[model samples]
Target: MTGTIKIDNAPLNKFHLKITAFTFGSNFSDGYALGIIGMALTLIGPQMELGTVWQGLIGSSALIGLFVGSLLLGWLGDRIGRQKVYLLDFLLIAVASFLQFFVDGPLALFILRLLIGFGIGADYAIGPTLLSEFVPKKYRGSLLASLTVMWTVGYVVAYFVGILLEKAGPDSWRWMLASGAIPAVIVLLLRIGTPESPRWLISKGRIEEARQIVKRFIGPNVDISDLIADGQSEQHSTSFMMLFKKKHRTRTAFGCLFYFCQVLPYFAIYTFLPLIFKAMGVKDDILGNILLNIFLLIGAILSLWFINKLSRRTFTIGSFLTLTVSLLLLGIWPHGPFILVMLFFAVFTLVMSGFSNIAQVYPAELFPTEIRGSGVGLTNGVSRIGSAIGTFLLPISLASLGLGPSMIGLAVVLLIGAVISIAWAPETKDLSLDEASQTPESSSQDVVSSSPRKKMSSH
Candidate 1:
């Protein structure tokens, strides 16, 4: 008789959960601030006496700063440690968020938003890396994806807050902008208590310290000594050029292309959604904004569910296809009832939610522990440049082409993203960070060598 054996997976510990919560909190703050800018720009344009050109510039200012910060800070995250970089990012975002209240004109607001974008751009790359490195392989996807959930919650909170404060008149936009400071404060306090990533420590030759952190969260029952030892042996002296080596070149290329296309459609749609609704005759701006938040929340929840269940490649492709189809449908039939508009918007949000959540996890998984932060940041920085372009161009498109053509253009961009995702991306689902970091070319070689070759009979 043959016996079946089952291996039990370890659950996350209290420390792991606590640290993840803090990370989630920080992400929520960053996401809330970003989401607010999208909606606020839509609502504040008329109220602030700003033209569409000025509005578009102000909306994209953060993205420009994000482009710069992600590159600079992402490199810094790898050179320093994930935890240390994350700890300081909050203060930067908080100070920037508060300073927005002092801005009196478009130029001033644009500069302040740029600073806010820089801080958020830094957090975007660092937050996911911190969460993924700290958790075990089994729960990493779900835990990291939960950042999307927190992000939705933050958006929802901002939506209601904006509505309530709208009654405070145009001046209340200052308060809404200032509210971003709260997350920075929370992150600052929580960061003081959070520890650095153990995986990062192991990569840096601080094995003993890494071991203690593992013991605290993973418990002393399992034998992690061997795993740590293996990591130490395989640790190569890392540099930025190492990311472009033959073995890693494909992954680096894939990461950059995937992120670039992903952001193009995402920011294009989001930055213009409220304006689209207004153009569609949604008279009540507050109500339209509230509906947009609802869709965002729904998308966040659905994304959290599918990110772990489905393959990363599958999710990215599927979401892009769905978004593309929805945008096409909206373009084909420009005039629709309120229900149809809501339905389409919901679909758009749902797909985007999945894209946002999965995108973060995939890039982090593609690089080694030592350079994971840089990998994520570089892609994010590149993606933000795309976002900056999209943000800058959307208003121009809307002015010249009208809503249908504008949305059709966005759908075309999403279709391109879907194709790139399918053709170039690898499936990282259920793989450990170490395993996921293996280049596709090397992994294919291993697969071929592992297979037994049959001897050919002599003819």
Candidate 2:
């Protein structure tokens, strides 16, 4: 016995990897649904003759739904089991997508999106948290980062598909909105018999059940005796207020506020990328979306590579600075030629690619097994408010203040995110979920029982 007895020693097997792939469907669907909105809005706004407030609501409404979904599903996952809450969300997404296809007006569209948002909200809260719980700690950071890539991939695919279908006429947007049902349906169908998070079972005091799950995941060869012992360390249940306790309070603040600052500007800028381009005289909406999604994919690829390598604070703070500078350039030179705007815009997308990747990992990593879903859900809920504010107000901001001022305002929000990252971003590169969430006293008391690294590799 030489190293810490963290949960990493549990086998990283095919079953775990399969779970990872299945979880991708949710993130992919989320990206597709949300990304499609920008294009959908561009078409619908004129047909409906929408006002600024209505435009804002339509854009932000799904995000509002996300907050509601996160709160409800997140708690439900913690109370019930992650798999149960996980499987049902995709059904909700499919239903909402179909409803969105038939909806007549902004009000109808808004309600439908809210329902879709709720489904996405559950995925946002549960996907990463559950993935982190299931995977080996050795690959947790990289594997979890892949969820963001899957999201970007879905978004990029939606944009490309939208471009092809542009010839379908104004009705094309409805088709685009409805398209998400395909993957949601696919993910749901694929999730048949997805296993419960053994960690959740352990948290619920079902020690024997957790043991059986560990054996299946790690293979029958290895003994999970100590693993079960380590897991039982968690108290039987947790309340929302417990997230506010001293041990976890700081992480909660960091989780909620950091995401708030980042998404505040991120959503505002990206949600309105088309409008921003249109105002700058870039006429081809399809080309504009293609470039944005391409750059976004490139950024996500870069993020996928760098997430494990970069220091958390350095990465987060640097990304915000990059976003701030790129956005500020757009604001300062409001009328810069297309190439200049495109260059800055591409640079901003590239920077956020990596940053946003880590942003997804942080909340999932911040808390312990007992409340990971609820905690991440709450933080994401806060992010939705930020997104809602940005989305709901961006149209008004662009109209009232023009491109330069709106971009500058967004840059200011990114700056605030940089500051928060500097102040609070925690380094989580190779740490176990349990290790990352350990209180100071707990860390001191729960000394390593053996060479956890050696033990983890034994099987």
Candidate 3:
């Protein structure tokens, strides 16, 4: 078997499980940090006497921070190493989270939120790239997909926590914001001493170190010769521009577009569900938000179960199609009865949650070890741009165009995602890492060379 195959086909073990747990913690922290702000804003808005523009700034500051953090840290991870950058990001998050309690004004709070987002962005790029390099291909989809589930869980739990803590008088938002520090510090401690990626090492031509890590953490018998040998022809570097080269450009574009489309609607809706529900004239907007987030959490969990069962292309295309249809129904009938409006929201959330399964994992899978960190980071940064735009605009859209038009606009975004997926999504379901990461032209060549007739004739 090839070195990539050897790594991909290895049995899931204790080490893999531990890494998954740590990564899940990282994602959970990220979800909480992002989600808590929506609820906190209710109090922050009034107490700080902030207007729409300031609210948008406060809400999207982290995402803006995410854009910066993802690009800088992702490239840094590639240049320095995943392990070195891994723990520090969480340290930054924990510190920022704790500082949220002391923010006396909107500016201080926005800066703090931006810092927290920056840390989460770094983890976004590093966590999946590291996990994908370690896990077996058979379980890779589900394991990596679980990261989103944890994020949704974190998000849902944050809302529930916000509801419970809302009784903490006028100062509750401070505690809600600071609570994210708990998970961040815990995950940071657990991530300590995690080994470096062997594939990354092999790509760097540190053969002995790669072999030892594979043998120690993975297995003694796992062969890495194929991995090292294959690297001979690759132009190895961590440069951001490398992702745009002919070999990787299509994947780079596809990664950014699909991720951008997915999150634009998701973050926009979830980050301001309370505002949206109020716009719909829900009797109890808070309870409605709770129920919707529950659906979101459920879909994320189901995605973990279904990811390995379905092809990546199928999941990407099907979920976006469903999302588009559901949102279109809601957009078309914004004046409908409460039941119908919520039904559409439920359907949209479920489909989007399912789509989240592929979002993080797909980007990491698109590039080889040589630039995996940068590739995931770049796509992540672009996706943040979508999310930031959505979050920034949702309040204004709700205020100006009302709910109907905004929902239709989201449908357009999902429709675009569906079109992109149908056009570009590849079948990387059971392929080894090296095979899956090949550029389209190179991958097609491999299929032809490895065809049954060619193999039979050669024999």
lDDT score for candidate 1 against the true structure: 0.74
C-alpha TM-scores of all predictions: 0.89, 0.92, 0.94
Tens-place lDDT digits, model 3, residues 332-361: 998689888989999888878878879877
Which of the two candidates, 1 or 2, achieves a greater TM-score against the reference? 2
Writing each residue's lDDT as its tens digit, candidate 2 over 1-459 gives 343333565557788788889889877886787678877887888988988899889888888999988877887788888988889998999998987888889999999999999999998888888888877777887788888888788877877777777679978888989988888889899988887887788777787887777666655554545556766664445577778776777678778988888888767777777778777777676666678788888888888777778755667788888889998998898777777878888888877766778867888878888788999899998989999999998889888888889889989988988776666666665666776665432231122222233235444
Measured over all alpha carbons after superposition, the RMSD of each candidate to the real structure, in angstroms, is 5.1, 4.2, 3.1
Assess the local accuracy of residue 210 in candidate 3 as a C-alpha lDDT between 0 and 100.
88
Per-residue lDDT for 1-459 in model 1, tens only?
A: 123211113467786687778777655775676567776775578777888788778878888888777777877888788887788877887898898888777888898888878887787778888877767777888778877678778767876777677678767888888888987787788778567787778777887887676666666654455456657677565576777777777678778777887777667666666677766676675676677777777777777778867867678888888889998888877668877876776788767866777766788888887788888888888888888888888888878888788888888888888877666677666766666676645643442222121111111
Cα lDDT over the full model 2: 0.79
Give candidate 1's TM-score.
0.89
Best by lDDT: 3
Alpha carbon deviation, residue 271, candidate 3 (Å): 0.7
